[model samples]
Structures are given as structure tokens and as C-alpha cells.
Target: MYRILIVDDEPMIRKGLQKLVEQSELPIESLRTAENGVVALQRIKEERPDFVFTDIRMPKMDGLELCQHVAEMDADIQVVVISGYGDFEYAQKCVSYGVKEYLLKPVSVKGFKGVLEKLIRTKSKVSSESFIAVTLLEQWASRMEQAVWMLQDAELDLVLDEIQEELKTKHFKLNRVVDMLAEINTLLEQRLNARDVYVMQRDFDLAGAENEEAVWACFTAAIHGYLEELKAKRKGKLKDPVEEAKLYIESHLAEEVSLEEVADHIGLNPSYFSQLFKQSTQETFVQYRTRRRMEKAKKLLQQPQWRITDISGEVGYADHPHFTKTFKKYEGCLPSEYRQQMGIRA
Candidate 1:
């Protein structure tokens, strides 16, 4: 189902389009009417519709001006300009402003339906590909947390490279790409908080980021500087025992390692180690172990040949349903959904 906004100065044409949409079998969720482009823009800002149908010559603001505004605000909205036969030449000029289709005045049932079907098909395909791109970026964010924690500069560079490539391949708009990078930064900051490493939000001058490369340059420079500060902080610490516990837990991610076992391995009393662990790292032993297992499971899910059951067992989950539930809680999606988004077949 989709929502549509009809913009026209003529009351008759607006009523006609509304009636046709109501009489049609297409899945239209709602319909809104606006007399001019100014009103249409107000409606769009209030709640964006999937499609906007506007007449070319309206008072105050016309369809062409409306198309330009929509393009600047959201690249996803499908704009169809309706014009009289005499205005057809004028409507053709709207293509440069990202108009999806130019419809002739007195819109016919056949022509309107064809346009509707075409737009829906295009939107569906983009939606699926966008889902996959977002999932990949999220996985990259998880890997980034590890790289920063271990102070691995090479791995950080590689992760950023992978992120930039994914964004470019998807051909995302500059604003959307910036939002994605901000999301990754938020995730990184949250994970770093557990270790008492608080980083100030970088003041990104994105006004100059008119292209994908420029955006990437801004993001990488800020992140690299943040990592340098993290390194300096690590150098000030003396012999962190928690690092040993983390190493052991990461190495035996497939096994259920108990806190007492880890404490004995690190030559500390279990009680003392438990308190020290919580003081040094804000997370408890079980919480840390679960987070690592879930992150490991996400990485394994990328491989299509690996069965979901085997991946669960590999991450120390003996029960399949439990693994699915835990994964859903951690990633906000099922293991199968995650794999599908990563381009893995069932």
C-alpha cells in the first residue's frame, strides 16, 4: 500500500483523480489534495507520501517548482506532473528536476495505472538493495568497535574502506550517506563507553561534501584523530588484567568460559576479579561474553555455506531457538533476515 498527494488548482481535476484512485484496484492507503505547490510542500513536510501528482500551472507555485523542492528534500518521492497538451513541452522540462513521470491533463485510467505500476516496481527493487546496504554497514560498525578497542590502525582503515565502497556501490544520496556514518559513530561511542572512553562528537563540515569521496574524506579524518586520542589513553594505563580476560574470552568464544575459570587463569581471586572486572569494564562477564558471541555469529552468518544451526553452535549456543532469540535481541533482526540482507541465499 502507498500514500499519494494530488496537487492542482482545478477542483474538478483533483476530484477526478481522487475518484479514479478510489475506483481502481490498486493498493492506495490514503490520498491528500493540495491546490498549489506551496500547500503540497507543506503536506509533504508534515508526512511524506510515496507519490505526488501535481498540475503544471497552479497559482502561487506550480508543479515544476514543487518537483525541485521535493528533490531537494527527499530523493525517494515519485513526482508526476500533469499538464495540458499545450503544456506538454513545458512539463518535459521537469525531468531535469527528477520528475518520475509527466502525465497529460485529463489523466486516463490506463496511463495512470501504468505509471503507478512502474513506480511501485522501481521502489520495491531499491528498497531491497537498500536493506542489504544498511545491514552491511551495521556489520562493519561491529567490526569497527573491535578494531578501536584493540587499537588496530590497519583494521580501522580497512573497515572504513569497506564502508566507503559499500556506500558508493549503492549510489546513496550524500545526506543518506552522512546519516549512515553518524549511525556508525554512535555505535562506536556506545561500545567505547563500556571502557570509560568518551569521545566528543566531531564537528563535520559536510557543507563541502558534495560527493561520496568528499564525505568519506571528512569521516576518515575525524575517526583517525579520535583513534589517536584512544591510543594515548591506552598508553597511560599500566598492565590491565581485564585485557587478558578479554583475550581469553575472545579466543574461546565457542566455549562457555566461566568468570571463576578466567580469574584463576589470570592468577587472581575469583571475588576480587569479579569486582575488578566490573570496575575496569562497565559490563559483567556474562554480558561481555554474550556480546562477543553475537558479534561472532554475525560474521559467520555472512558465509552462505554455513548452516544456521552450525553457526549457532559455533557461537556457543547449543539450542537453535535460543540463538535466534538472542540474535534478534542483539541485532533487531533474525539470523535468516541478516543473512538475506548480506546477499546470502537460503
Candidate 2:
């Protein structure tokens, strides 16, 4: 017998949500609604609902603020944020405030029901240790996905070790570990390009591993082999115009590199080269060059001997102010601030 609250500005949306919850098979004893966070906060204080489904934007005090307030008042109340595609990033921020789930706009009946069911199941179980284990496992899964995308072997190894340690510390069941491995396979499959047959074969091998140690060995080998394959493919394709263009960019990072210059150097039309570069590298020539320049700048920043202006010039930026601005936008901090934060003394 759990209480629930639905908060939204639109009357129709609020009513629709209420009807959906009513139709749900969850053991909700009572359900309530509020037009905005201000009103919702009052209802929450009075009713103390076990769960709240909220929309991100409203007239008075948006969903994020509401979530923050609710967190302070009641840490146990589960929050499900409803957001549109445009609000997706804002919705991700809600997770830190203990949002249990996010539902996009025009929420499907199935999605709604699934979220409600998970919440109901979790509420019925009162084990704090179980909750913490699930949280840690989910965090580890996210880190693993990031590591795979960045092609970071060391990071992937660290994350794998962390996952294994988490399982050992929590003493998770064998079935749970297998489920986590299945999830890892699924994530790797999503990140790996479809055309990578060798990596896909390795993925299959990893999935077929019979034991924990086998799974670990197979996964490590598979990922390492995949990265090696990517490197080999890049090297093998040196005759490719795109690869030549990339080489030209890398060699001319300290110069004012241009698309036309690289295209001409590789004996291709500028327009065609632009398309091929994007198709092969998944980034525009300008974007790729800028990224390379930023990477160089970061490496140079590590050396205390190099002045910020010198680093900017070395990265092909004549204007130090522009370089600083670009670096801040890319790395989320000023050059001096980043240097200080990274412990590189002047």
C-alpha cells in the first residue's frame, strides 16, 4: 500500500498520468496530483507519498528544483522525471538528486508500466545493501561503456577490476554476475562498428566464456584485440585518401591547416574529400583538426616551461585569447585554471 503523486503543469497531462497509474497493477493505495513544484511540495509534505512522477519544466519551480527540495525533505521518496528530447540532458542531472528513472514525453504505456513495476519491486524489498550493490554495478557499467568508446585500454582494465571487486565485496549471486556480463556484451556490441567482423567474433568468444575467470580473460583479450584491429586497419589503409588526409593534419598541426590543402596534397577534390573525411572519421575536417590541436595543447600544458601564449602558437592559434576561450569551451576550464588543477606549477 504505497502513496503516489503526479506533478505537471498541464491539466490533461496530469489527468492522463493519474489514469495511467490507476490502470497500473502496482499496489498504490492512493494517488495525488499537483500543477507545479510549489504546489507539489505542499502535497508531498502533507501526504508524504512514497513515489513522485514529475515533468521537467513548469511555471513555478521546475522539476529539478523540486527534486532537490524533495531530496532534502525525504531521501527515501523515489522520483521519476518526465522529459522531452530537448530536456534529456537536464533530466540526466536529476539522477544526482536520486531520480530513480526518466520517461520521455509521450510516454508509452509499456515504459510507464515498467518503471512503476520496478519501483514497486524495489520498495517491497528493504535491504540497503542490495540497493547499494545495484547502484555500484550500474555506475561500473556506465564507466565501462565510456572506456570502450574512448578506446582506453588502461581505463577499461581498471573498470573491469572495479566491477570484479564490487562483485566480490558484495558477494553477488552467480546469476547476477552472468547478467552483468551479458549487459557488458550488449554494451560492447552497441559501441563496436557493425563492419568489424574480427571484433564481433571476439565478442562472441567473450560471451561464450564458461566461468568468471574465463569471462575476464576473454573480455580483456577481446577488447585489446579489437583496439589492435582498429590500429591495424588504420595503418593498413594508409593508401586511403582519408588516412592520408589525417596524416597531413597530424603533421601540420602547428600550421594553419585547411581542408583544401589536405585534399590537394592527397590529390582529391576538396568537396569530395570533405565528405570522405566525415564518412571515415565521423567528424568534419575542421572538427578533427581542432581536436588534434587541443590534444597537442593539453600535452604542451603539462610542461611548466611552456608559456600559455607559446602553447597557443604551437597549436596553430595566433590569438592567445581565442585559444584560451576555445580550450575552456572544450575542457570546461580556463588554461591557467586547468594547469593549476592538474598540479602543473608555473
Q: Largest TM-score belongs to which candidate?
A: 1
Local accuracy of candidate 1 as per-residue lDDT tens digits, 1-346? 8889999999998999998778677888889999999999878655567888899999999888898888876446888888999999989989988886878867899888888888888877876776435566668877887887787878988998887777778776555576678777776667667666565344544433545665676677666645655664656635566898899999998887899899778655454466557656898888889999999999889988899999999999888899999999999999999999999974
lDDT of 2: 0.75
Query: What is candidate 2's CA lDDT for residue 17?
Result: 92
Which ranges of candidate 2 are over 4 A from the true structure? 127-346
The whole-model C-alpha lDDT of candidate 1 against the native structure comes to 0.79
Candidate 1 residue pairs in clash (backbone atoms < 3 Å) = none
User: How many residue pairs of model 1 clash at the backbone?
Assistant: 0
lDDT of 2 by residue, 1-346 (tens): 8889999999999998988898887787899999999999888655567789999999879999999987775335789999999999989998889897999999888889999988987866743445334455556656755665566767877887776676677564333355566566665555565435435324333323334665555455554444444544645744766778888899888899889899778765455466557757999899999999999888888889999989999999998899999999899998898899879875
